[model samples]
Target: MTVTNADRESLRHGKITERPLRDKPGYPSWAIKLVMAVTGLIFALFVIGHMAGNLKLYMPAHDGVAALDEYGAFLRTMGAPLFPYESILWVIRIVLLVALVAHIHGAITLISRSGKSRGKFRRTNLMGGMDSAATRSMIVTGVIILLFLLFHLADLTLGLSPAAPETFEHGAVHANMIATFSRWPVVLLYVIANLALFLHLFHGIKLAASDLGITGRRWRVVFSWLAALVPLIVVAGNIIMPLSVLFGWVS
Candidate 1:
């Protein structure tokens, strides 16, 4: 099709009458949502499961790694390794990996452009509606969360195996939780990370809602509240798990 002046005007207002979205780069809300929907559902479920697993701190033998290791074994036995749930968890894990990557990709793209679009008047002082803290510090907080995840997996999941003649001994989930969290340094790190995560969610989630086309009359507010609340709870919950141990609630 040949370009016409009329077609250009319509495209400027977000109409599909002349052009399709792929040819454009301005705030691909649909792409943001595609990333959100693809990743959001399963990651949400993981968040809940993660919280429950930490709650095992409230269990008996809650003093050391033994409790966590036991729970981990119980979970493994219950999942697809046993029958029904194993395949499901693996599929979810793959989906989660993709979603996380895509979500981050969309965010970076959007943020980078927003920076270019606002070049001169870009307020180093304060935003029109955005809080400066959130706008200024996303990269740092995100990197911390990424680092924490790696260390977490190494210490808990990878370190679970006992050092012997290649025997897979039961892990000490309880002891480990207690030991890891009870340490002042670890808890401090968690507290700082969770706080940053809280701020990130406060901004990113509402942006996600808008990106996902969930911005309705009242539904947006409801979801925005839930999004903020959910992260705070989980982040704080993780921090508290260790705090409890440190203060002798577990041990």
Candidate 2:
């Protein structure tokens, strides 16, 4: 093998070309974005369904209680014969849990990478105002929402809260809701948590839309409206329940 300048240059170029290929083999940026988008949308759908179901509290007490109970029962009995009691609900819960984990992981990874890339000396923009505020606070709001979700499950789903109904019957959802929200402190906590949820949801929707390649000059207005409206609707529906209870409107 003759050693020449040309051979040495070719070897150096080959090694340089292989460096990027060997840097890392992991999920690509687009894959991470897609995971975040898909998981976010799934979680959003569950929230919407939950809010809609909770709205049954507005039906007159006799009807509302029964209706809410029936709704609870229906969820448990879904896919009966084909699946055991509550099987469908468990499936949905599992799916949501997986999605939630994936979404959080993706968000954390992306946020960490972004922070490292931007460094600590990045300039601030006063003009960003609410938009910037919402974007920056996503992780904080998300954490609050997760904590609230755990508390909610303890209070309602598991009926393990000290404030839970005396009997804690399975299908007595309306009564349980009224029981929990009747207290001022619970109501206040719910209101604050829901505010965080609204903010998180609004920004999440917009970010997900952009991630899914649904952005451009033409789609900007539509995405903006949808991002705002979807979160508004979900939060409004959720907040009204506690407010109605607190105000004696839905007793």
Candidate 3:
């Protein structure tokens, strides 16, 4: 006596159930989810550290270089004598690039598989509808953030024309940020990107927690608060920078 999907659905009464995972010829859903969870955690840590470094721009400059500039220099020259200048920085960038690729690939694969299955594997709603919008719009927000990242790299890292400030100077982290944010349009772009990031991070942290099996009943409330709080603090730290520069506080 085989249990058909229809029989299972009737027994479940329209509720989504996690049927025994079929041996799909491609990547398994669980593996994809694990990749996303791990990579997302990596990104979360990176963003928090990056925001902290960005905040150093507010500290007073000495000898014509801002604290943020010194910080940037430190990153470039880290592990010197044993390692060449920028070797460690490049290694970090390569790791991030690999993680970014894995995270994006996992996201796209899950989205495709979910659409094909049509909620066949959806688990019980752990979030209890707290972030349905963010949950639904993860890929959309991810794409927006991806575009913003490319634009950001061009603006700051590459110092490209039009995207970068007219006064763009390599290694002049503080001055470059001020010059870029002095323009109203650049400030507006950062604000919009940060908004998208807020939603992405808010729901992503919760989902990652769920995927990683951190869903004990006793700690659900605490986890939810932390998921929201982390994104809020990150976004606040990021948004304050451009606004401060645009309003002449950082100059």
Candidate 4:
């Protein structure tokens, strides 16, 4: 049955005038969250795979390079045209790109609204900042990690010269990684990036857990610690492998 204009007006002035559920899952807020979670998990898998592959660096040079070569070959074979790596990694990347956009858009939206409602204010330094230092610091460190990730892709994914790449290194991914990480500067950058990564994850993981309805009072502290610890282990694994390469401990 169609409502008359009078009925429509009445509804609009009452229950129908209530605020929309933009804060709900899948509308905008929680949907971006789901995307973030999935992309994050996929990224974790990549981290694990990389760490395992880099474990080769813990071996002697000839042995390690040989091991790296084997892993690289395996990846290429699997990534060619159609394979799990092809669909999975590429899909993850694309989804992550989308998720990132959504996440950033939502953040900007919320932050802007917050600022508009609260009005502009100034803090001379973080010591005077309204929130905790870590929260303020997250933005800065997160930007650093973003920059590092872009540079990482340029050096490795784009196959730029790495001070030591044979002719076979054209399609040879692993050779380029070894050549790059063998440098102390690159390793140093990676170490700094990992520190930033830890900061991002330390705050982010807990935030995500809390948002996803896992906020039992008794369990929250435990989950928060686990959230922080897991990423520390993963990022530490990444940092150690590159350092191992340059220190002559591995290669």
Listed per candidate, the RMSD to the true structure in angstroms reads 7.2, 4.8, 5.8, 7.7
Per-model TM against the reference: 0.71, 0.85, 0.86, 0.69
User: Higher-lDDT candidate among 1 and 3?
Assistant: 3
Worst 10 residues of 2 by lDDT: 16-25
Model 2 RMSD to the real structure? 4.8
lDDT of 1 by residue, 1-251 (tens): 76577667777876646434345666575666567554654555576688778787676664533555666766655654557654655666687778778867866776776677777775665564444676577677767766766666655556643311122223656555555665677678778877776666666666566666776869887876876787778777777787877788767
Query: Which pairs clash in the backbone of model 4?
Result: 26-31
- Sequence-dependent TM-score of model 1: 0.71
lDDT (0-100) at residue 22 of candidate 1?
Answer: 42
lDDT of 3 by residue, 1-251 (tens): 66566767675785655665665546778888988999998998999999999999888888977899999999999999799999999999999999999999888887777777775666556654648778877888899999999999999889999899888999998888888989999889898888889889998888887888887976777768878998899999999999988888878
After superposing candidate 4, which stretches have Cα over 4 Å from the reference? 1-45, 59-65, 79-88, 121-131, 161-168
Q: Residue-wise lDDT of candidate 2 within 1-251, one digit each (tens)?
A: 76577756777878434345233428776889899988988888889999998887776556434677778888999999899999999999999899989988998888776676678767578548657878878989999999999888878898885746565665678788888888888888888998998888888888888889986877877878877898889988888899889889886
- Winner by lDDT: 3
What's model 4's TM-score?
Answer: 0.69
By summed lDDT, the worst window of 10 consecutive residues in model 3 runs over 121-130
Ranking of predictions according to TM-score: 3, 2, 1, 4
**Candidate 4 residue-pair clash tally:** 1
For residues 200-239, could you state the per-residue lDDT of candidate 4 as single tens digits?
Answer: 6666666666657777887788867766777778788888
Task: Locate the minimum summed-lDDT window of 10 residues in model 1.
Answer: 161-170
Candidate 3 lDDT (Cα, whole model)?
0.87
